[model samples]
Target: MVLRTARVGLRLTRGQRNRCFGLLRAAGDVWACILEINSWRRRRGEPPVAGYQQLCRLLTESGPGTFAELDTAGARSVLRRYSDAWFCAAARRKAGHTDVRFPRRRRALMPIRWYHGTFALDGRRLRLPTAAGCPPLWVRLDRLAPYPCETIRSVTLLFDAGRLWIDITAELPVATYPAGQQPDPDRIAGVDLGIIHPYAVSTLDGAGLLVSGRAIRAEHRMHLADTKNRRKAVAGRAPKPGQRGSRRWRKTRRRARLVEARHRRRIRQAQHEAATSVIDWAVKQRVGTLSVGDPRGVLGLPAGRRHNLRLRQWQIGRSLAILHDKAALAGIRVHLVDERGTSSTCPNCRTRITKPAGRTMRCRTCLFAGHRDLAAAFTIATRTPGGVITTPAGMPAGVVTHRRAGRHLPGAGRSRRDPRRPAAPGSVGRLRPAPPPSVGSRSSIPPGMDEDPQHTTGKPGER
Candidate 1:
């Protein structure tokens, strides 16, 4: 079984919100306490405590109710988080990475987790464990958890961008299909990951698929433009380094956070949709193994500032991860292969040709031409860590499927327009007449007409 997590927002009353925040703050306090203990130890030239058992012992010795509303389970989760972070930093440092730092910074809120037995999930309501003698705390979820209740293993309470969300983790079995519907183990496909087209796929059967990311790119651009304009508008209100800002500044910051969070959510949902499309397509095509081109090697190189920002916004790592997770659940095996020469190698002539700047690649030697990403994906299919798998060198397939990701994003569909963009110069925003009132209603009278029959718009009330 594989694990998946769904983040669900919380709908809380004032008191519930306060209590939830208290729990998160208590988790933060525990984190700070751990850091303080470690700092003192470091100053004394002692090895810092980075073990869960030791931390739990320390917590027990400190007695119960040390953290307000934080139960033993929640507090232990925080301890585990700190221990994990400390060890992770230590490992990186030992591997000749000096930049990695331990968790020294304190937070006002830290996520707390509770195992299955410690929490109760009933429809939209959740019962969280609290400190001894504290009353039971029940918080409502804005929506039901996506996973089956029995499969849920844990729930994590986290605060993000001024909102409270719970991450529900569940164990799920891989997908199974009946006879003739299951993917054939011998069928293989190649995937080329790119910025414009997030997934370019080709198979030996002359079938191909391309998932466009143009909508996602537009979202990023619009959000970036909006951010620049917002910064400029707020520049005058920004306080000096030491000066305290008024309430307006805080309000502005809060709105900015909400906007940022919404952008992230939109992008995340779109990516998921894209990955789901790929998986569904593969399943329909009965593809069992996917050879994915890994482009992370060149990501570390110094690119121009503009290109670097584009790469960062591309979020290639997340894309790969989401695809992998979806593929795994669909019972498809994924393999990552070097994509260094995939683009330059010609599928038609099997000869080296300089990569083209645009989406179409031409091989002069064989007088062959085809879609660039698809050709690259086809070439990549032949290469694996074990060596090339012999297959028919095929040109770009004419029977290709086109799909668009982020179609639900702002300005993605024709029905919706991005709010970030202003109205056309000298043009007004969208305007429409209100629907006509019911035929028999007296309120349907136009503004120019009088409500009373005697006051009708006539020279002498002829009616």
Candidate 2:
């Protein structure tokens, strides 16, 4: 199915607002009840239960959280809607033999509800069904509510920053042009994932591109400082459970959550921008496929006193996942190459090099040198076109190949090589830290990596 999503702003009436709130309350109640049942199981030394259907039946029969505005029918329906994810981690814990810890419940926001249907769209307001007995409550369609589209599968209502909004996700149909037109293999781009330069870019043309998100580190530092300050202030007189609802505690909690949410929003937006930019360039260059470095291995490194502060700011794997999805849509291919020794191995001589200085990688064996990240990207981009990065589950057939070369941080050498590292055939050695290139050095592009005129290939796997 081809799904597309569009956000349509709403103009809601007061009654509609109340109804929306009622719907949210109902959803929250369902989640709370699920959590409560799991908590009961925990206390009884029994395994927690998964699924919200049973709970939905119970809630429907019990007639809970159904106010005048949030009528019984709307409440039950809303409860049933978001039930798939109700148990989540609790269910995992139950299956894994882990003890379940009950979550605290918050007071319900009253009089809100949501309706899904062939909601009649009349200008800004959407008309949806309500309880049979009561007159329908019309909500003021505002920034929070948007007219639902046929393309969307579901809409999630979120209350944040003292306001309510709906997050709509639509499944978009993949764009198809012609078969046999795979991206050009010659103009490949090597991308180095990093904290400072979130994207270290080097195309087959030897041009360098740096997409940086340095402000993220600073924001994280501020958050850390604020967290510490709050921690120290509460150290001497940590409040009990009931006392947590104190004004000061509530204020601090809200502030902390706001800061965290802001950080996440910024990081997510940055990743989207970076991924879009890279994908656009690849499509334009008609690069046949991409060999991206997998840097998530850096996450397991100890968060000790010597930790790299830069590591905490970015999620390289997440960015790559977004890139991969977009590349598929653009009909560009990506390969995950083994990142082992990618930064350390000389691109020219294939000799392992020890990184000796800041942001610089030098080949001790052949004296070949380059910035560390670009070298890894180049190495990945230069791999034989057919190579695939093997994962624990053997490579699935029919997807485009993207090399998976991972970076080795400055302090990572003392530990033994991780067995789970990507298994690429070329250069098997220790990875070394490489310095970031000076702002404007001419980056060397890998051979056979360039954008050529489109050569039609087979159609992408059907949805």
Candidate 3:
């Protein structure tokens, strides 16, 4: 079984919220205590108490009720977090990364986790483990847990964007298909990741799928504009460093957090939608292996500010992670291949060509032209490690299937307008009606004025 985790918001009363934060604060205190103990050891030229067993012993020696409302299992999870981080940093440093640092900084709040037996999940309600003498803390979830109770392994309570959330981790079995329709191990597809098209997949059978990300890009642009406007509006009210903020400023900060969270949720939802589309397509095609192009190498280069912002919004790592997780659940294999020359090299002639300015790539050597991303996918499909490319006959055909991600986005529909936005400049709602008829209108003017006296008195050119 594979492990998966889903984060869901918590619905809590004012008292419950405060209690939850108190538990988190207790976890933070535990973390600080460990750090302080280790610091003392360092000062005395002795080995630090970084081992989990030693830390548990230290905790036991401190006795009960030291951390209010925090149970042993919950506190141990904090120690586990620290131990894991410490080892991870040590391993990285050993591997020639000098910048990796062990966990030393203290936090005001730390997430507390409880194993399955320590907590109770009843439909939408969860009973968190507290200290022995404390009253039972039962909190409601904003929505029912996605996984079944039997599959749930642990729950972690944390705060994000000024709101409480719980990450529910569960073990899930890999998807099983019917006997005749199981994924074929030999069938492989190539995935080309990009900014405009998050996923461009091409199978060995000449079929291709393109998941457009225009809506996602639009969401990013609109969110950036909204954030800029908000910051400009609140700049004057923002407190200086070391100064306490007024209630109004705090409210603005909260609003900003909500907006940022909303934007993140929207983007994450769209990315999942895109990855789901790819997986569904793969399953339908009976494709088992996906060769994904890794473009992270180019990220370290000195790109301009605008390009950097674009790359940051692209969120290549998150895209890959979602794709990998979904693929694993579907019993599909994912391989990350270097994508250095995939976009520039022509698939037909194996000749290096300039990267296309638009989405269409043309090969002057062979006079072959097609969608740039699709071409990259086709090329990436043949690429294997050790600088070898295996090309099957009749590969990289012209047939392609197009799909769009984030169709649920506000501006993704045919209207091309977000419902939350005001009418555009030339739209019907914003257009002004023509001016009323002038004062010389026939109905409002006198009869003589309407007849034009000078013309009438001319007597038909008699002079």
Candidate 4:
């Protein structure tokens, strides 16, 4: 539940940009040189090296280098950054991976200038040391805090769209659960993840909620196609390994690079929005227990183009990650139950159906007809180890209600009419409250009438 907020980029003059780049390049060069030196050593019969301060000094003692000299703080920070990178690389290698690839000086590579403890924060500016025998550099801010400045560890300067920007890394704070919430034990929710529908939630109450993610997938594909075209155009042009910068070559390279970055960012934002909406709905429903089918296995199968397309639309893993994380913060329990035969098996009857084309799903044995996603959701919702319903346990607390339906005499003679007698204390043995008069629906209640505090049926304001 930790939240990260960023302030818009601050406009920097050309001089300021150069200074920032100077500090950034100094740091990048330190890391790059260290990596190269380590590679060379590994090639020879020499041990791998560690720590870059001594190496930094040796590289810039009295040479015609980009950086005139190295300061103690900058030198130390560079070493620490590379050390962290080395640890990460080691972890990846330990997981049966091969050699590590050091980061290159790409357009959007890390541009960290200030260290965690070395840089001092003025009222509206940050100051850090750099080489090149220049004065200490300062990053001026328009306001004291455009975002939660306290959370930010450091800001890295970056060049994007011919404009300078800063990428701020911050320690996001966790959000607390709201008041008067309890976990619902009796109710379970099944989610059918898809690209077109995004989320198809079938609650114990038999209500289906469809949250469309069409725009999200469409935007992502659009950007992806644009990127592909740009890459193709770049590939068509020929260039030598050490050719000097040409107008067309640089222009195409820059365009391709920008498209790549923008497209990734667009996809990220869409995912955040889609996941947020799904999580919000789950929270509102007070869903104590949630089960999302693992579609990744199916997606990995060698299928036809259309099948693969549908599978791609189902970002089940990503959506599930969002649910799990949000539910953890909210204290709701989430389970990754076996999704095998969830859609094929009927919830009402244990009969399995063969794959049917199009969107409708009809249980051959039970004759239960419903939307395919809704049917899958219902099947998922009905599954549990024991038939007995209990309160859900996990992240995000909520309340639960039990209900049952059975035949009753139309006009049975009774000695005395008791209001509480109809409810039967334990299970809500009856239908839901009839639709409001305005809706012009039947007075008969729908099956599984227990209300969900977190999510409600046909609630106009529900988002």
Candidate 1 is scored at a TM of 0.88
Evaluate model 4: give its lDDT: 0.56
Instruction: Please give the lDDT score for candidate 1.
Output: 0.82
Which stretch of 10 consecutive residues in model 3 shows the poorest summed lDDT?
454-463
Clashing pairs in 1: none
lDDT score at residue 328, model 2, on the 0-100 scale: 74
Q: For model 1, what is the error of residue 415's alpha carbon versus the real structure, in angstroms, after optimal superposition?
A: 11
**What TM-score would each prediction reach against the true structure?**
0.88, 0.63, 0.88, 0.65
List the candidate 4 regions with Cα displacement exceeding 4 Å.
1-8, 47-109, 113-134, 140-147, 158-164, 182-188, 224-245, 288-290, 304-337, 378-463
Better of 2 and 3 by TM-score: 3
RMSD (Cα, Å) of candidate 4?
14.0
The lDDT per prediction is: 0.82, 0.53, 0.83, 0.56
Decreasing lDDT order of the candidates = 3, 1, 4, 2
Off by over 4 Å in 2: 1-18, 35-123, 127-129, 134-150, 176-190, 202-208, 222-260, 306-309, 333-337, 382-463
Q: What CA RMSD would candidate 1 show?
A: 13.5
Candidate 2, residue 367: CA error in Å?
3.9
Please identify which of the two predictions, 1 or 2, would achieve the higher TM-score against the true structure: 1
Query: Over the stretch 146-185, how does candidate 2's per-residue lDDT look in tens digits?
Result: 3235555544445655456544556666555555554765
Off by over 4 Å in 1: 389-391, 396-398, 414-463
Quote the positional error of residue 243 for candidate 4 in Å: 7.1
